[model samples]
Target chain A: MSVIIFADQFQGKVKKSALEAVQYGAQIAQQLGVPAVAVAVGEIDGAELSALGQYGATKVLHVADARLNEPEAGAVTKIVAEAVAKENGAVIVFAHNFAGRSIAPQLSARLKAGFVAGAIGLPDTSAGFVVKKNVFSGKAFANVSITTGKKIVSVMPNTFSLNPGGGSASVEAFAAGLGDADFKIKTVKVETVSGEVPLTEAEIVVSGGRGLKGPEHWGIVEDLAHALGAATACSRPVADSGWRPHHEHVGQTGFTVRPNLYIAIGISGAIQHLAGVNGSKTIVVINKDAEAPFFKAADYGIVGDAFEVVPKLTEAVKKYKGN
Target chain B: MKILVCISKTPDTTAKIAFTDNNTKFSEAGVQFIINPYDEWYALVRALELKEAQGATVHLITVGGADTEAVIRKALALGGDEAFRVNSDSQDSFFIASQIAEIAKQEQYDIIFTGKETIDYNGSSVGGMVAELLGLPFVSIASKLDVNGGTATLKREIEGGEEVVEVSLPLVLSAQKGMAEARIPNMRGIMAARTKPLKVVEPAAAETLTSIVSFELPPAKAGVKMIPADQVEELARLLHEEAKVI
Candidate 1:
């Protein structure tokens, strides 16, 4: 009966991806001749949920349960699935994060809906609910049609731009009436990493590779990233060689990302690495090698040593930030 | 402890993607298919490690036609105790997940695993679907896993960092990197695998969820332009003027 949006929350605050999802869901709801409603699991302020109308939501459904706040994918999926059935929603939009990826497919199965991931842009309502998604590791695009009765799609992080209008949402409490049977799994503990932004959810990202030489030289990249309010990442070779931690690896064998601005320092663009990062909106490459393959894929390329260029770039960023 | 790791065969990472035949089917002509790299690392390696440590049975399960058997055999040669081919092409994540769930429901498996996602479609789904259908606990992207008696200790990777979690036995996990280094099969492992049992089963139903319409390659890029290395000021000016991305 409506387009349902799962508004992603981080530490009880709505993330940028959630706003984008809300905007997307609202737009789709308008196209489908239905209302745009928002769904939130765990503890979120009713006022904030009501405020999501600025991002295009008309109404918000709140399932403020303490168990929903943790890393239990099953619990979230159950609540969302039951809510979707109750709301008579035929389409559900989500931000393709860890929780979304873990929960969406299962929900699709339960609802018998067509599911898609890594989606970008608006759905082609002109043609039977077709969606554009990246395939072949961001090297290609696909226009897939969902003919099933219901549909689910997880929009890739940082892919869609959120354009909010002046409006407020009506928040109402929703009860999926879930119990212990809904829980196939439980999280005993949750370990959160502070200080650094999540790479997948970051708007801007600055990445370094083995070319940085040592950990001491990381200050340059860190400084630039901090000034830009960006997350940091590294190449697989750098992670393998111990120049950076394995989580920093971004490639086919590592994490796939799609950030608005991706800056690469001292990293030669390998095809495998490009497969992971090709989804970035604007790529900036900083390296001394003119023949670096990364330059071909970059919107901007600088042929200079990262050691020299990074410091200068960081200084410029600091000046730009007015500090 | 018998471990069954499901592996999906997909197009290589660098292949040109397109659709053919009225935009209803994926065009795989001239494309190379490999065992999903994540499956090779996470699921395959973990199964081999369990086989080595506990001297248990390790089986390779895949849902595909005859062509996929090669990769399943490769997994068998590597360390699998047996192989099972679902004997049909996977339709959607639900169709595939339901088939796997059916098989799991009929049998007893101490541990079930898979790669986090396939690179070709990047559909990081299915595993969670299977887990839900079978009513099993699942940990996504576990970089480390240990099973002692009936409990499991998993080091799962979060966005910015990692988390150490513990769960009961007979759980499911989507293995990511740092789980175990993938191993190549030696002559002994290969020879012993040739005689191992391989059972092919038919899926119970057809796909009703999703259908691929068409695919297209990414837009072509202009040639790479080089700036003088010593002209740092010029580079800054160009970033502001020509690129306008700074």
Candidate 2:
């Protein structure tokens, strides 16, 4: 039996989180005294698939099914089940990103395997397999024990460092024996805002709240974000008011990020907003109100008007970076 | 069309999360519970909009006991026509999915909607599991969804992108942000909801696949180091040299 990692791909290219999953699975495989293998469904670059070995996969199974390219949960579930059966996979690892969140549960149901999502650390295998996950947003933590023999773990992105050391992986094609009837959803088109770092994968993020006043003042947040080469995000009110797109909203109801550095401008840091960003390694809050709740959670606080402080901060970063 | 929107009761976004009973149980005392924002804002609102436009019957469903009835009524006040409370504590995502799937199979709902995940548990698994159990197409984390004839158009958030997909009716979708705006309960809607039908159903037998072994609070942060507004350059230098995160 081997540990199978779902190496997620975007338009035939492997993503950073996918490599992280590979490394995680490889680590678990080492703990289990078994080989770690990766399974990629749909179109994939063979060279890239083989490169997964660098992240610890000893072998990569590429299921080049055209129908599996789109983000369809059912079809991917069937394919993963087939791959698991073929590889005698005892444990499956996935990066707790969009694709993993979509497909992992369905696979768990199909296989009756216990599943854990948003796992922040490696599993504790002393007595029984226990995985630690974020609960109550980021305020609390729960250690879950999976009783089932077959298990699925979706590791949170940016939580685990990617350690590349293994050599090349042997890539092989596996037939899913799937038909057109396997997929029912028809993908019409994909529209991306494009050219901005995804919040989940970004190392640094610059976020704005209602303190920025209106959409016209977003340039300050954008400028700081550009200066730091970080992703841009907004609080829930900003997204709800249409001052920014929902995708840029980072809060309890929005996307959760664990960037290395999170800079909050004009944000009051409500409990909900802090839930999403408390995972950041370092937090900086800039607001005029010294009593703003955000300052309590910030590693560093600047009590000033964001409109004035943000531009000066941007200039400072630009000057520091010599850009 | 018949729509089923799953609502989860969660602590108010501003509630100070606390745990008691040796940190095994979430402390409910003094903590205000509300309909999960994702469900109230996205799933329920979208369903209400569909009901208004197409004369569809929207039903709000939750898997809990008396503590959740108020939240269910809140959902109805926000615009659902009816409500159902599965009379059992949700054991886990699998058990919750099983309960929902059983009702959905018997009722043959034209569409099912749920928030991406509950704020408390944050397990984004129930919708997909229910879809799998019911043999229906599942679109997850859908930011935008529209129904036309027998087909449903949806935009789901992917990594750094959005995907536009279409599936036929009798499908399931997990609502995310941007699906719909949150609506507050008006006086008329609240009065109307007081008389709305809220049926309690016995939960079907199901086994939880996982259990919480223990709970702990996150490590406390160090006290914030205040930087004067005039010291912007120093702050940047500290970020670069001290925090080493710039």
Candidate 3:
């Protein structure tokens, strides 16, 4: 038996989340006393596949199908299933991102394997295979046990720290007999956000809310985020008012983030907003309203006008960084 | 055209989360339930818009016990033609998907719509499972959708940006924000919803692969440390030295 990790890639580069998955799968393999094999599909570089070994993947299964450049869930499921069958995989690991969320469920249904999406920690095999995951939009945690013999788990991004050690993995080409039917969903166009850390993957995030007054005042938020080398986010109302794009909205009905550090500026902490960001390791709140609910949930709070405090905070961060 | 939209009830976003039965089950006491926003706002509303534009039938489906009828009726009031309640209390994602897939297979819906994920479990598993069970193509987290002829064009969020995809009819889509605007039930619609058909059906034979062993709330914060507004640099120092996160 082996643990199989889906080494998800975009434009030939492996994602940070994929490396996390590999490390997670390797830990599971250690628990089971089995090898962790990473399966890569589409147009990925051979050197990049070999580098997965540093994350504890013992071997890499490469399916060099250029068509997979745009991941069609159905087609990718078939390829992973084939890899699992060949390797006698007992557990399948994926990063619970957009691609994993789309593909893992189909794979679970196709294999009749028990799946736990958005898993936050390693499974407890001491008794049974119980995986811990956030539920209620991070308001609570659920310890879900997968009873099926074959198991699938999609680890939430940023849940685990990356620990790359010294090693090398042997890459082997695997052929998945896929047909046109497997590629039914056609990708007509692709638009990638360039030169910025994606919110979901950002280690540190700086966010603003309606208190910023308007889109023009967004520079202060962006300035702090830039100083911290973090991604920028906003509250729902700010996005609703078109002060920021919908994708930057970090709240309920938007992206859920668990960054190492999250700074909320001028945002009243609504429950819906907290649901998405409460999981951050450290929360910093800055608002003139000391009674803003966000202050109650914050680790460090500054009761001041955001227009005045944010620019100063940005300068402090830059000064701290010796810039 | 016939469309099947799946909706589920969830605790209001503000509802305090607590567990009963040795932390194995969610406590329903003092908790108000509403139609999951993603389903009601995006999936159901988008389906109603499609129905209004193309003169199609919109049917709502849910997998829950009798208490879910209120939410189902609310969905019907938002312009669904009929509704179905698969009589089961199972929280298992696969079991729920199987129940919906059985109904869709028998009814032969041209399109299946579901929320990207429920607010309670936050498991976005059912739509894909249902699609796989019926051997249909699935597109998830669709932000925008346009249908013409027998094909549908959709835009879905990728990691960094978005990708536009095209799929034929008889597919499943899990809707997210930007799909449609949320609608409220008018007085007339509310009155009409009372007389709408809500068919209760038994669940099909499906195995529940996962069970919740326990539940736990996050550790409470040790109260906020207030810093003087003028000493913003002190806050940065604490973040760097104390929090060590920077």
Model 1 segments beyond 4 Å from truth? Answer: B14-30, B223-225, B233-246
The predicted structure with the larger DockQ, 2 or 3, is 3
Q: On residues A1-323, what C-alpha lDDT tens digit does candidate 3 reach at each position?
A: 99999999988899998899999999999999999999998988889999999999999999899899988999999999999899999999999998999999999999999999999999999988999999999999999999999999999998898999998899999899889989989999999978788899899999999999999999988889988989999999998888898889898788899999999998999999999999999999999997899998999999999999988888888866777
- Taken over the whole model, the C-alpha lDDT of each candidate is 0.80, 0.88, 0.93
- Model no. 2, DockQ: 0.76
Candidate 2 colliding pairs: none
What pairs collide in candidate 1?
A: A1-A88
Candidate 3's C-alpha runs over 4 A off are none
DockQ, every prediction = 0.60, 0.76, 0.85
Model 2 spans with C-alpha error above 4 angstroms: A319-322
Instruction: Compose the digit string of candidate 1's lDDT tens values, residues A1-323.
Output: 99998886766878777788888888889988898888887888887788899988989888888777664777777777876877888899988877678778778777778888878868887868788887777867777778798889888878876677789999889887878766655566567779889888887889998778877788888888997788899998788777777777888888878887789998899888898898887788998788888999987778877888777777665554566
Candidate with maximal lDDT: 3
Chain B global fold similarity (TM-score) for predicted model 2 against the true chain B: 0.95
Report the poorest 10 consecutive residues by lDDT, candidate 3 chain B: B176-185
Question: Which candidate number has the best DockQ?
Answer: 3
First chain TM-score for all predictions: 0.95, 0.96, 0.98
